[model samples]
Target: MMNGHFDTDNPDKVIHKGEYENSFDNMREIALAPNTHKFVLNFWTEDLKIELERIRTLDITDNLTKIKYVCNVRPYYYFQFSDPDGNIIEVTGKYTPKEGQFV
Candidate 1:
């Protein structure tokens, strides 16, 4: 789980807290136009090769999608997918041993 608040006027914010069973931050963020729920997805994988494989085999509809797995890099492996509209979404995940490890 990752949660935080941003400057209402700013276009970005920081990651304050993240928790998972493993040492990874498997979080997904979606961005879209105002007054709309349709958006795009930003995602990262532990291994691009492995993540790609999982992506190919998973069923990611608008309602049944979640973080597939952890990404491979420090910031994490990145991929962008879109909704019906042209909104932008970002998904990222990482593995840390404890609370202060991911940073």
Candidate 2:
């Protein structure tokens, strides 16, 4: 994962890597910083609603979480929440690629 890079030529390709920089607590602090907390994670599913519902049932608290469904520029759904150490996690539905867009 450390040696991997996202293909700039393909917007639909997703990258996966393990958390290796800091401990969960410190990562939480970094994630909370303005302009640094945003990390888009894509999940593939045939039924996005069902996947969303399953994520909603987890033991996540609302105080440190935000969820929304957006359809303006493109149609998609996502939820952001802080992990046990306060690091924000964004779980988003599959990607709908558009020409000239990086997403």
Candidate 3:
């Protein structure tokens, strides 16, 4: 039986009972690679507005690049941009990433 908080019909929510430990143990000491990457802390609600100030596009590609605007509890927007490393940066928005996608 699953906890009432989750729908019992959902397979992802189904788990064998009594398998969880009272307190979880940390296994971080042995298996992870030595720290070489800088860590960034994301504060979900702490004035994240500035992070989506502008959308910058580079080395334009044929694939579709656009932001999906979602308005619910918060009016959030998405901005998609390509970096010099060819990595796509998706920033939550107040505006769309591509000019054509905007009004």
Candidate 4:
């Protein structure tokens, strides 16, 4: 189960425990850039801020630097970091999708 949503028999659909919002499952995998994949872990703005600050205080390798960027069309704030496996992990929040926006 993920985020209170359970995997359904339909590979493309996850059954949420309550009212569903803008969630989707793409059944097919697409080619990603070298050392990168489209796997993002989102968090609330406050939570992300706290977590990022905590990470900065850790005496970890310098490779785990944080990079911030914004998506103008949908308007979200996020930071990206590469894991040991080279998969891109994004800690994101503050999504301001326009009405009728298809995420």
Candidate 5:
């Protein structure tokens, strides 16, 4: 699919939309090269607990061993897991910081 960037994940009826399209919608898409290496992907959300619980409910999901915070400089809550092929996927939530602490 990488040669012409074919739509392997999408349904047959739908094709990719570029910036010039009028009926465009915001949706997540992945660009991958045909290689043996795995990848890491991160996303942000308003609630970390909700997303964490959602992942927990999936019987086949695996929890990652990474830290609970995105960085040592700030308190960005996050969680990570691996796909079946071992590509890492992360989801994080941002909290308001006050007095160098987050709620």
Candidate 6:
């Protein structure tokens, strides 16, 4: 939800908080911005391969990392793509625990 105060000078214009009316900040400059921050989250599961296979059937342009077997450290995956905008939508499943090796 977008909320703002009415511009004091223009009675009808909505100005964002901390912004003044008639300021250069009101200009529209659209462009794909470079990602300067990193945000990564993981979902752990014993059936990593099952989950990966299930994800594959969905309508997704990106992919879930590995789909063979959950047999390593950190079987659940995450991936940050190297595209200009650094596509992080390519959800990756990394290495999970090996047999008898609990991680």
Question: Which number leads on lDDT?
Answer: 5
lDDT for 57 in candidate 1 is 65
- Taken over the whole model, the C-alpha lDDT of each candidate is 0.35, 0.44, 0.33, 0.41, 0.47, 0.33
Worst 10 residues of 1 by lDDT: 21-30
> Sorted on TM-score, highest at the top, how do the candidates line up?
5, 4, 2, 6, 1, 3
The top-ranked prediction according to TM-score is 5
Compose the digit string of candidate 1's lDDT tens values, residues 21-103.
22122222212223332323456556544453465466452422233333222234233334445344544545333434422
Output the lDDT of residue 97, model 6. Answer: 45
For TM-score, candidate 1 versus 2, the one ahead is 2
Tens-digit per-residue lDDT, 1-103, candidate 2: 1111222233365332322234222334544557544453444566544555666687564532233443333556555555665545656665443443322
Clashes of 1: 14
The local lDDT score (0 to 100) that residue 83 gets in candidate 5 is 72
User: Candidate 5, TM-score vs. the true structure?
Assistant: 0.46
Model 1, stretches more than 4 Å misplaced? 1-32, 37-44, 62-77, 82-89, 92-103
TM-score for each candidate, following the candidate numbering: 0.27, 0.38, 0.26, 0.42, 0.46, 0.32
**For residues 2-102, what per-residue lDDT tens digits would candidate 6 score against the true structure?**
01121233433432322222211222211112332233333455554455566666635342343332212223333222233433333334445465332
| Candidate 2: residue 32 lDDT (0-100) | 51
Worst 10 residues of 4 by lDDT: 18-27
Cα deviation of 98, candidate 3, in Å: 16
**For candidate 3, lDDT tens digit of each residue in 1-103?**
1122232234353332212221111123211425311121222322223443322233353322343443333455543344444344444434334453432
Off by over 4 Å in 2: 1-42, 63-67, 71-75, 94-103
Better of 2 and 4 by lDDT: 2
List ranges where model 3 is wrong by over 4 Å: 1-64, 70-75, 95-103
Q: Which residue pairs in candidate 4 have backbone atoms (N, alpha carbon, C) closer than 3 angstroms, thus clashing?
A: none
